[model samples]
Target chain A: MTPQTDRRLQPRRFLLLTLFLAGALLFGLVAGHEWASPARLARAFANSGGHDMTSQLLVVWRLPRVLAAAMVGALLGVGGAIFQGVFRNPLAEPYLLGASGGAAIGATIALLVPLGLPGGPVLAALSFLGAWGATWLVLGAAGLQGRPDTAGLLLAGVAVAAMLGAVRSFLMLALSDDTVNLQVVLSWTLGGVQTPDAGGLAILALLTAGALAVSLPLARGLDLLGLGDDQAFAFGLDPARFERRAVLVGAAVVAAAVAFGGLVAFVGLIAPHIGRWLIGPRHRALLPASALIGAALVAVCDGVARAALPPAEIPLGLVTALIGGPFFLILLMRRLRA
Target chain B: MIAVDCASVSVGRKGTSLLRDISFRLNGAGFVGVLGPNGAGKSTLLRVLAGLRAPDAGEARWNGLATPRWPARKRAAFCGYLPQQFAPAWDYEAGDIIALGAGRASAGDASPGHVLARFGLTALARRRWSMLSGGERARVMLAATLATSPALVLADEPGASLDVRHKLDLLRRLRSASTSSLVVAVMHDLDLALRFCDRILLLEEGALVADCSPDDLLAGDALDRVFGLRLQKVRRHDDHDWVIGLG
Candidate 1:
């Protein structure tokens, strides 16, 4: 192909991808405003201009939460795409490597300890450490006997996740009667878009950007990788190195998202598959498309959870699982036939 | 010119050796067919030579630079590899699959149109890979591998699912390719190997037992030991010997 035509198509393709993502983002913003009128949203923004008590409440209390939702949802979607592509398994997700379970354990620990520290930062830091730590453990275990094996890593992840979940359950049982504190823990566990502090949002945004920067450049390599490790190596890729980098980047992104947004499921598993179904497996396109779709899906789900019962907000995680569970079954059935 | 040199190479985990100490060099352009029994490590050797798997004891040098030294994308640009199966993760169109061969080059390099037409896959260019027959998919994969115009092509079991006509046609194409490119293929069909391969490497128990030109390798004793078959080479009107094996 001539460079001229490639250059031409590059902008056209970029525009289309941008348009798709922009459309999704716009839809998310619009849907977010469903419960609050434009006047109310405007007033909320306006009242925050003075840095007074009302401003602090509006800015710190409201805007941060909504922005956190968007940022976390976007990160999970993109992270999911990367994991699925790197593993060459349509079923792979951020939580498949035990990141979520580890994070849950960390959060459970924070909750159990009466540390008097603000829960958000402590939870975020613990979750990040837990997720990355679990990933390292899985990698270390896989590397113990021989070189890393995809199946081995997956099996290790499942085992570790189950173990962590059992421990978390035991901890939860121990704290079963602390109603006030338990409610707080339950809300976080059930996963909601609690407004993060400005500091947390900034950190998450930076981490997400870094992960995307590191991963998007590997789009072509990811395409070749989908053919299988042997084929990928034959095509001049160092599969082991690529796998390590992918795991690191994926783990980091998922950690950041979970730390900020709690245990939002389905976006990671479903977004990439749906994106692949729509745009094919070109990672360059799949990454951005999945991010948009994932963000939109979560945003819409959050909207429904907030308003579905009117006055009683449903857990965002429950809503996602309810939707994702059936969707997963349908995909599995389709894959079986194929 | 592409030259592959494997010196005292071995591959495996712990003590179970897949490909024992093996060494060979193929420099000039010609088709080299690798013939081996099921456990003889033919595919492992192919993978090693293609830079897919590293040898535990030795190394593979491509034009003296060492396989691991060259940048992956650069190496891929010059060496095309086709595996036994080409199943993609998604239902990529035949055209898209071909385009992957072009690598970092613009999508135009593998004008999906031109390649599909060349491989008689024009009608199926828009079809999902999963929708194609084994034979059709094989042809499309072959087309994709060749789209890069690499100097060396390593194909593992390229003719496994092909029909007789396609088998013959593909062999003919490989033969033509040898005029300008070095082609190494792992073949299961003894007759096809003898008919199309300029040289044949007969492997037994993960070791090179025979390395000779097709005419010489098909001799009675060598064929009997390597393939465990009694064979007769009859001269055809076309000046090529027809190898007939009797079990």
Candidate 2:
């Protein structure tokens, strides 16, 4: 008989994760070009409303940026975990599965076309459509019969991402003469927290909240799916319906994240894997844990992106990719070796 | 009670029939063995009967309502389905995987814990999917299937990959399940089927060639005709006999 996985150390791990998230949030709040001293932040926190310049900067600039980063990170993280579960592949994530690719294309189209008639930002709306459309296309193409074959789905995701990348590149080149527009689009393509306006942030928050609410309850269904379609069916869940619902929620969350920043490459992939390592693979604990870790990872990355070169910020996506690309390689090597 | 009323299933570009107008009704708890040659559509019939697939024509019903009409959870609560080959790819703990079968905390006395204990798998709960031996995985799958206390247990070749000891162990579990739940298994072992099954369903080319007790089936020479082999019964004991197949 195989020995049980050790459970005694999980509480300590959870504690460390929580502390890391808090520390990351603090770093995002204080570590900018004009560093807000820990004493100043504490005084501001105690005062709530003050006539100080530091307090106003905290309210007007820092708070929204930090909040936006956390929400977007959580969205990608949770989206990644769900995609991994639905696809039954460790490498599956929102960016790799065509959700963010679709979102990026949609956001770019909105930028180029200038659809002014909208209750919400045209960019956000189009990105949502793009996200849902691309993810669904992958699923439908992989297999519309019931559950998708993992290899086929992964290949389809890669194909969709590649085709969409070509379209995005053409659109970006079209704006080469418009250097300002090109710069903005370029930042987004590389994936980073652009830190939206209040309205944009509100929409992102709403989308993130709604997607997470739906995903947590379906954890058990995801667990069943790891076995395969036939076995999940025998266990009572309509595996097809489960896959569709997972796509619907996952796509929406990914779109909201990508709409703000661009591709935001590795948060989804990195967060869920780390979450699984920290907590076991049961989606119940794993999903929430992934969301927390994702929020922390992006917040810290965004902080570093801003603080790295005081006057000039590094692209957040570039930073994540630097970390994520190697992480992906290690995982691949391990899988091959095994 | 479970009944398949003129259920037909066809597939492929040529519309080849997999199960052809098969009909049968089985009531209460008893072991029913489905026997067939290669390409006889035993697996197809099992899928149709399990309501995992909708038949091209007619219906498979539990009680009076068509099983397809039942919500997936209700179907899961009522039926246990075991495929010929099923092994989870993820590294979920064996206990967590088995708990996936329980629609409620306890289905009569058939909770995940109870089923695991019954299979002497209480110590194996912590084992991950990768860590399990084939025999252990087989037993774990069986435990998960039975955890819901299903009214109907449908097994497709449950004994396909085990050694003699594990095969007998699996057979005994199925036999016990049949005491309270109807067990329908796609079986290849003629000797085991004759010894354990109360009834046998012999299919030839997607047709129900024989539906009878072991004696009636043997006396009628249906096995001889279907398998294209001579069946000779040799005396072993007063209550048991050894059946041999020869050209």
Candidate 3:
């Protein structure tokens, strides 16, 4: 639908914008290399029988990073939308609920002690478990009275996150002398989407899909919940039950994203808001729009991370925050005017 | 016709009673105005009647069924409640908000367009709630409540922030709506309540002080005692009764 005639396709516009964004990022990724040129790309595609060094680098290096970035971004974007809708607070995100903190602490401890398993997968597993533990603890604290307490859950998340932060600090100081262990911990926690192998990519894909499956069905409930618990109840919804389900879905998404790309921030928070601003607050359109926007944001950040500095890669989280922060300000200003 | 029976219901919280041993039986169609001083359990009584809150003692029943026994979805179909302090978090269109209430009603509820037209809110159907004036917002909310075509409507402070014209219009619509449904509203304006309500329930410190017609209530000293004021009659016409408060 054309923008002149229809607003129903407002979200479609945002999705199309994301596609264009992805195309630009792919162009940058393929052509940004000093040795790589249009002639090389054309030759690589034209000559199918013999493999060249350029084609090998394209397949082995660039493709994995792009796919991981898109997957992780979709997870974060969807998770952020669920969290904000469930909490009925625009500032709410997966990280705000302590999932990332728990994952970071778990990954740190796993790195310090050799788990006798393959390093990446073991760390990912522990991180996932840590995030799950945090979610349960938060829900338990909120459910002390048999009924789920929204305010209590938020408070509990803050306390748990602070405690986990302290524990992580203590561990870092304890291993200050061992530069190798410290470097591993810092690299894992400080944010970067490492190029994953085929198996790792498959696991990430499964986890993200599972999170989406849980979240999409509850979109209507989330809209009701946004009106507040009492209003939602009056409208024939079980607010506490919906809140529990939404939180679990958000936590699962956060866990999966953190395991793959350590502590990437703002993609979850910014993407949903952008989606809402582009479209309305309806979750049906908001969910997919946010997911696409998130995927594009992260994919572009990864492209810049790799290609901007030649061989010296910038951290994914830094790139996102630096750009997302200014973008958020502009959105806020526009909202105030409207 | 629906029958509401509050069998000695009492609600207390934090060692303070909000409603104490209140009993009432209402049947068929009429407009009921619940009047009370500040913190006199007007909203609490509505909540208890709507089945959102359970009383500490006794029970609220609709027909022969206990309020708590009715499934929420079913209860929502026949019972429309407009809370005292409600502000929608999202800035939805007026028509959309009405549709949300329409969905809470039983299937084949009145269309949002029809309800909005009845409430004189058709012009503002496309306007977002955030852009509406306070009076317009109140009207939109009332439209939403009425769109459900509920058998029983419990509205708290439906005319809280409206001008005199809107307030009178709201009471008139509520009065007419009672021809097909039981309408109970909590009001602070005594004159409006007296002029519009078919019956009045006066509450004082969580106790039912008086339950009668407006004429009977005006003739008694109970209102003076309950309201802590000396109410004086200024004038009375065949269609209107004017009372002035000499505090």
Candidate 4:
């Protein structure tokens, strides 16, 4: 809001973010089970049917994985921004608020219990339910409807997530003993980008687009919500009704992101904060910035995870946690100091 | 055009009431000051009348329609509320906050620049809210409150943090605004309310104790008893009165 920040910050922000994302994309395309040159990667990306082994490897596996990472990251980032904006709480994110846990539970159910539905819709629907349920439980427990309490919400989120984690574990165990396979549990727990499938990647992309389409219009109303509930009502928005719609959108986005790649932690948390700190705090700028920055963040993390060890690979969630935990701590310290 | 009929607001069903069967009606533009001590349900009344809160018992009516039943957007277009406490969770420039009043939601035509200039605050538009002084921030918010040029302006303690000069300036502006719009404000300053307000609603213990002209309030026993202080008119001038309170 300073005069120093006016007119100069926005374009520069997009420029820097674009450069950052390009670098991450190149790094993502290049570093994998086998190293491909950036040029070869680009060629493979442009021409999907590359006959050579390295080109095929880049085209088939690496490209979809990287794009999926970017898509999931964008969803999480925008989801986090929406929650933070509507709730007016800096710490509001899917992972911290237990929405991810809810989605995990729903996804595990879809994997274990055969509803005869296809993998995509079942996963999306149940995960959406889980996410929305967990978010509402947190809000109700934290008493967010009546007052602003960061500490209360944080505690409530922790408690609900812990409870949901227990449920997820029990379901996973029962499924492992009965008929369901164990690999899905491992991937969901480790939270990594699996070998990419083109159709799944396409679905992730579409869902990301749909969530963003719904969220963009909610910006001005969310801005009015930053004013107190009574004041928001005076300004023609019912705070409770508007919050339900926004929370539903945010939960849906987070559920879709998690369904793609288990539970990628802190892309949501880190991307939105960076956008808010570096750029202005308006939702219009922050939402897109958060998505782009989040895409870049996850792409870089996946690149680092694969490239860090030669034959042995680190989990994407662990790397993100290693980076995001410290970042969250620093943010917490700053907020406490303020 | 604005009225509350036997309206009541309470905490829980069969719980302690915040407002106890308050009833009044206003037909035209006037500056009505709601004067009370702390926790006298002054803000609660303002919220009900502004259509922000529906009463548990009766109704807050605008042009005869019940507020809670009215479509929310329509009510917003009619009533403008200025809260006693405005906590902005984000960092925004003064102009940005003012612009919120006119765009996207309400079909208000009075632009932010015009409202800012009306308060003689065109300079503070671009400044960070953190950089502005308390008085300057309050004025900016006041401009935002009036940006829509709402028919009924319900302000809760609009000048609670202002100095003498700023308080007088704010009151004068509100007085002028009242020529076209009904302006109701919760006031703590008895002298200013007496000098500037056309009518006064005296509230005490979750009840409307008196509804009368400001001069009648100054001459009445309710003012002395409700506020738990001796309030007197020391000297009278044509334009204003020299009133003081001794507690």
Residue range B1-247, candidate 4, lDDT tens digits:
5553434444223777788877887778889999888878888888778766667777777777777776876677677888887777777778777877655244545677776787787788777777788778778877787777778888888777788888787778788889988899999888888887899999897788999998788777898899898876777657567667777
Which candidate achieves the best TM-score against the true structure?
Answer: 4
Which clashing pairs does model 1 show? Answer: A1-B108, A1-B109, A65-A195
Off by over 4 Å in 2: A1-13, A30-60, A119-121, A144-151, A173-181, A197-203, A336-338, B1-13, B104-111
Error of 1 at A209 (Å): 3.7
Cα lDDT tens digits for candidate 4, A229-268: 8767777788888899999999999898888877888888
Could you tell me the lDDT of residue A113 within candidate 4? 77
Sequence-dependent TM-score of model 1: 0.84
User: What TM-score fits each model?
Assistant: 0.84, 0.91, 0.87, 0.94
Q: Each model's C-alpha lDDT?
A: 0.73, 0.81, 0.77, 0.80
Per-prediction tally of clashes = 3, 1, 0, 0
DockQ of each: 0.43, 0.67, 0.46, 0.70
Error (Å) of candidate 1 at residue A40 is 6.2
When summed lDDT is taken over every stretch of 10 residues in candidate 2 chain A, the lowest stretch is A1-10
Q: A296-337 in candidate 1: lDDT tens per residue? A: 677667766765776677888888889987886676577557
Candidates 1 and 3 compared by DockQ, better number: 3
If both were scored by DockQ, which would come out higher, candidate 1 or candidate 4?
4
Error of 1 at A307 (Å): 1.6
**Docking model 2 quality class:** medium
Give stretches of model 1 more than 4 Å off.
A1-34, A37-64, A106-126, A135-158, A169-185, A197-199, A336-338, B12-17, B104-125
TM-score of 3: 0.87
* Tens-digit lDDT track of model 2 for B66-180: 8878887777878899889875656887887777876433356766677778778889888887789878888888888888778889999887898878887898899999999
